[model samples]
Target: LLGTVLLGARRFRGGRNPQPRRAPPSPTYRERGDTTESFPLDFTAVEENMDNFMKQVKNLAQSLYPCSAQKLDYDMKLHFLENSSVTCNDGTPAGYYMKESLGSRRWLIFLEGGWYCFNKENCDSRYETMRRLMSSSKWPQTKTGTGILSPLPEENPHWWNAHMVFIPYCSSDVWSGASAKTDQSGYAFMGSLIIQEVVKDLLTKGLDKAKVLLLAGSSAGGTGVLLNVDPVADLLERRGHTTVQVRGLADSGWFLDNKQYRSTDCHDTVSCAPTDAIRRGIKYWGGVVPERCRLAHLGEEWNCFFGYRVFPSIKSPVFVVQWLFDEAQLTVDNIHLTGQPVQEGQWRYIQNLGIELRNTLKDVPAMFAPACLSHEIITRNYWIDVQVKGTSLPRALYCWDRSFYDNSRNNKAPPKGCPVHLIDSCPWPHCNPTCPTIRDQFTGQEMNVIQFLMHMGFDVQKMAQQQGMDPSKLLGMLSSGS
Candidate 1:
């Protein structure tokens, strides 16, 4: 019965409903120490458990939806960029998913993140990675968890029923470039064009009617939100949604200009010195610099690309979410980009990044700077539970939203002396256990899986049977891990 229903579901590609393709295999649990996990199951055992659980899911799905006539829409519907020529890094069609439901006329548009690449070689490598990691074929038809994109109201109280749009990143330009194709490289640097087209499409699809708009993204997408939020808001206002309350939330995209860590040449450590990449990106993509940003920075137009520099210039109230010791800086972009050793100096550099972030965004309406070492926090399983200063991250965000909207409606200044939600787990490098970490091995995979299921509105005891684990043991593990 499940097979019949699955076969009957319309599969969309390039606006055509094609024959159903074989569902992709479940993703393997590639362990990252920075990802907060609550249960420590053996890696192999987790894989076996996942396989068993998936089988049960299939069976349960079959029983729940016995009629093949009941069509199951893909969690994210694919809509290619309106322009015929623009495509992703791999030359595949670029697109976003609009998951509409009955809720507020408010909108929560999330920009998906993948890091950027500047030079031709780096761009080519990024293109290949996009093909592997972001090919439309790789996405799951059905999203099953909670947090940022969750459809369930219990999990995402504020945003569950809003017009939720997820824009995929494929341009390797952080959605800020619009370069003409050059003979030197075959890649299309049309990220700016992609953003323009996507926004236009959304405007036509009732985004002009949005009472509230929260433009948010993670990593590169987070940077994209900062770069494009004003333009997007302007587009809506011009379309007669002048009263629409638009705000931005940049998650883990509070990138800093760590010139202290980069080499003199500036070519190798472009990630650390993001302005260099931004300069190349602007020229390559034919992107426009925000006029206010240009005037604010004056001679330093490239500084507009870095968040710390740009945050002060944004007129819209944006909530900044970041970690004090972002694990990505420690492991991926910073040291990895510059070939710097993980010494005391590197630690100081990370701390300084946080300091600059705080100083730059001190005046922003809302900020969530946790002392965790993790990178992206909003979409992770831990977002619902992870707390700093006795307030869960989500709760803090909700409160911020309430305050922001209330202030906007009432025409009142934000209450003075209100503490910024800066959650520091202090003691230098050794993070507080309660703070999220991907570095610990004893972290439990089982707990992660259980929490994920709970977020999806599943019964843990029933799901545990599939994994050949005792439900009580799973609960205990989760308790201990927490």
Candidate 2:
């Protein structure tokens, strides 16, 4: 209702977009098909949507980085061009495939990484390090094969051979400026479109909606995950009350979605927000720099959405495989839950899995692989998967970890570099040798947070819903007009 009521039928007022709602609809894979790409921006806010809280989040993100960032001239910006290629490979007209197998396994709709639509945006050192982190934190080169994931290749017995689709966040035609407004929600449009295409094709091909997996890389794609997952769940649940859980959510050095550092947002929290994560992200992801240098492109500097408040509800099981040393985008704030840092990567990974199982047992199975991973190390995990066993499960927390340094966030080395070559290794074989199998520079042997998840089952959503939990439930945040 927030995005709906605020954005009604007016022209984009500019500045930050209000919430977001249905434009009038002409309205598919069934989910994105239902989404219409006609809406305006709303610069009409005395305060951000969440008001005080949004200010706090943005300030927190901004304070983490201290260098003077380049301010947007605003005159140099671009919008949806009448002819910009916003339609090329919109992620539609594609089929889902297993990254390593085929024949009849679970299917996944994956997206590629490329944080900025403009190749020029990669100039930032932090952005570059984030790219390196992606090599480990997301689909590996050995696995995805030059960006095109091999759907259901007949190689492994456990290969989840099923229909899968890969959606690229920025269309080949979208160019750079097509979405410099409203927090890049336009990218969400592309993601939704791809989801629509994949769904229609899947249904037409006889695949069950409940069996679909939604995956994205980096921030824009991750935002797409937020936009698509819940809607996909709604569609699948409509078809089969017992929907299958989405298996893996490959997030790599993702820090700018939902909530990011911004002006007028993190006013007070700026002084107290945790700096360790930012420092660490700067250390490991910035490649000798800090997050500010990386995110300098964002003129608004608002934590529009954070992992704590953005992860969509999973109809099926889910997996979150992050790195132990990634430092691209650091923060203790949980952007996925919409606003719950307490439920971040491992925490939310656990909480969400419980929620999924509570919703369905066999249909949704949770799994995880820390891969001794980090925000930037995701792409490497795919290569590490060669040593990782079992299919990617839905358990919230699973696979890899080590806290060599007590308070690992700070006092850590810079986000210098990573083993970016791992992405090419096909389904890195599962072999969790006790010592750093890949001769990893980092070390920690904490695997399988299943028991912890089972234990959290007692609280999970109920606890999250509690008034004084972690973020100290807003109580009225979700049910307010202003």
Candidate 3:
């Protein structure tokens, strides 16, 4: 199945766009929280738009103008901070990858996401297992960008021309630590200091003249953005770069502080218990929180790690992009089975998770929340496919960017169709037609190779024709595992 899907992806990348044997069944919708009433989901317009977009993608693949040129200078160079005090968990010098675009004053600095280790036991275990994350010794000299970091204008329309910086997660601190290697801990954790040093270095490399600076991250990095967005802005203010309009874009980071579906002992596993782990991690990592948040929680600095707790304290304009049913959160919360044949109680729990997320995001000035069960956005090739209310993430982000500038200047609402606060109020996961197909290991409804390839932008009919088989027959055989 994987092989067949890869073949289709390769063919599509080669610029072929064949029609499918048939369009998938039309979707059904219900008013949020209204169980009795059902509505017909009209995807006629959406399909037309998607077809046009696929055509655009096909054209870009064939021409490859921006992609070809982008490849020439998109290799981000790795730079170790000169400040010796800033180091990764293994005492290795902390570093970030930078790709400078000449003639562009806008900057997008993205922090990479890797789940953190809060205590000495987990940190030690992390070093032996995921050494590359804990140390910078094996980081590549040059790395290419993708998703939002992509230099290609076709893929990343919003900030494609901007100067891009990719900060790897190495401190095991979620980019919030301020401690050095101690005899007792046996490791340095300077995640917070590393970011400050990176900014200071960029001052010499044209950041001083930047008109717009967007700080973005996914998962743990997303949480880091919430914890550090204001500080980064204040850092620039202190350095006299007050003209730089700093903003944040957090992806898949708004974790709910809700209870687990199946409670387990804190010592059993960190993946199944986040509250206890975070509580212990704050002290072990010497984590720093924004002043307002620290004061709000007083003694419980760990609350800063949760988006709902810290978002109220953020002063900068931030655009949040999150999956309504985040897979990572479900795993940690012990809500593992989300596929078909879901138990009654577990399904209710899943629905409630989406409700909680919607309620929390209601007050956020700018956001795009889809009714899906996945993690990480903004850096995916198919980000354009996922939309809420017919607005793609890029489109929503563009509007949010414009709204920020407009409101800051004249206090006007966003333009006609540009909606920044988009949340799917639908009850269940994958209710949105634009939502990606969910693949659960334990589900009875696993996608066949044809469906998988189709989701990946392949022409199923073309694949069937090339194999000298009828598309319908091929699908039948694959379905029966013949």
Candidate 4:
């Protein structure tokens, strides 16, 4: 019982568990730290023993500190920026949702993800459809943080106690615009400015005393982190906050500048899309790139928008979390996935996309790149389940955090069994057992073994008919490669 409690306490205090699938043969009972006994385990006795141990611990804790029993509220509150110049696309007052943890000196500012509008037609269409993202008028007064921003300890193990800040995406500029409303566009694109203003506002609200600040974002916002992380650190340093260590966590933002399966002359179609979008949107939004990247690109500042292009210029440490087969990238490349099987050429193109992602992520010092076909991660409820080489995302993040501090203290290496750079080397999708379930968009049903085989460029229907067997029963003969 004491050994079990000690192990639990060690894990709670941030120790590596390293629970891999297979274990090597033990040398002996003494070497394994066990005292073998010949007694049958009693289910009722075990429960009673644990209950009595917990009760005793609880009583001792109360006697040691009577005031520790009181619970604290960690509900998020809405706060609008006091500055009038900082506004959204619709000219509404810019704001952010914050969940304060008075005891913690750490801060996590998360930028929400919504795709950008490149031109006036796109902005006009967005205002008509996704008004909530374009305008902050319809935003809820209060919200409960979930996923990485979750206040619950069970959901977010590492940063749950930190002060959480959720900045909604309202600028429609991929969080890089610096221009106000224009006569031609008739919408303010102050995304970069909004982030600056939020930090300035936070400085007056306990942020001045913060020790560690993690700037994180998803999708477009993730790209924003790459473009703006250094600027945030510069802002803090310029204002005399030199002690704070600023880091970035970008999720699903490592977009590749690759060619589509079918090239098209038209720029508006998915075959030739974001290339045109980035080229036009950079000027349309009056986008600002990092000084180092701007100096490097000179004539073409839009290159800074891509992760591989701008990542080299970023001095601050950042952790990239991207899917090997990103859904958004597939859609933009005109590779539409459905319930039906894909063509042979389409399968090859999809496989190349994963390879390209792996190649791009090779230099990233800290990242969790799983060979899955999904988009956003950090904000998903199942973020905990997704693993790379038996190390979950949360555990990888914990190890990365430790390594950062260890480096700051001039340590040579990270803790044993704690991996930071993890990537799925598998060649196919869903190759990792911890990969999330892939569902059909039209039917909203989980893809079964037949569909999975079909996705791998196999004509399962034809094979089943030829063998005089149902495709569903082929699971026994074939593996999903997981």
C-alpha TM-score for every candidate: 0.69, 0.36, 0.78, 0.82
Residue-level lDDT of model 2, residues 1-482, one tens digit each, is 34433443123223233334334433324466445332322211221222222233223323332221123111111112122322322212222232322233345565554433222222233234443311122322222422213221112112123344444333321111222112322121233443555555455444563333445444334534533455565566676734555443545422332233322322122211333222322222211111232254243212212232233333333333333222333233322222222323445443333232223222222223333323332233243233233333211121211111212446343222211111111111111221123312233334232222222232334444654554324223222310
Number of the predicted model whose TM-score against the real structure is largest: 4
Superposed by TM-score, candidate 3 places the C-alpha of residue 249 at a distance from the truth, in angstroms, of 0.6
Residue-by-residue lDDT tens digits, candidate 4, 1-482? 45655455544433223233344446873475344232232212222233334334334433433333334345678899989878999899999999877557789999999888877876788899889888889889887888788865566767676789999999988899999887888999999999999999999998998888999999999999999899999999999999988999999988887887876654432445667778888898999999999999998998898898899999999999999998888887888886567888898898899999999999999999998888999988899899999899987887887886677669877788889999999766776767788777767778754466565676656656866988766455545443
Query: What are the runs in model 3 whose C-alpha is more than 4 Å off?
Result: 1-71, 338-340, 408-411, 440-482
Clashing pairs in 3: none
Candidate 4 ranges beyond 4 A from true positions: 1-74, 264-272, 448-450, 459-481
* Model 4 lowest lDDT segment of ten: 39-48
| lDDT for position 206 in model 2 | 46
For all candidates in order, the CA lDDT equals 0.62, 0.31, 0.78, 0.80
- Top model number, lDDT: 4
lDDT score at residue 139, model 1, on the 0-100 scale: 50
Better of 2 and 4 by TM-score: 4
Relative to the true structure, candidate 1 reaches a TM of 0.69
Candidate 3: residue 332 Cα off by (Å) = 0.9
Full-model lDDT, candidate 1: 0.62
Ranking by lDDT: 4, 3, 1, 2
Q: CA lDDT of 289 in candidate 4?
A: 93
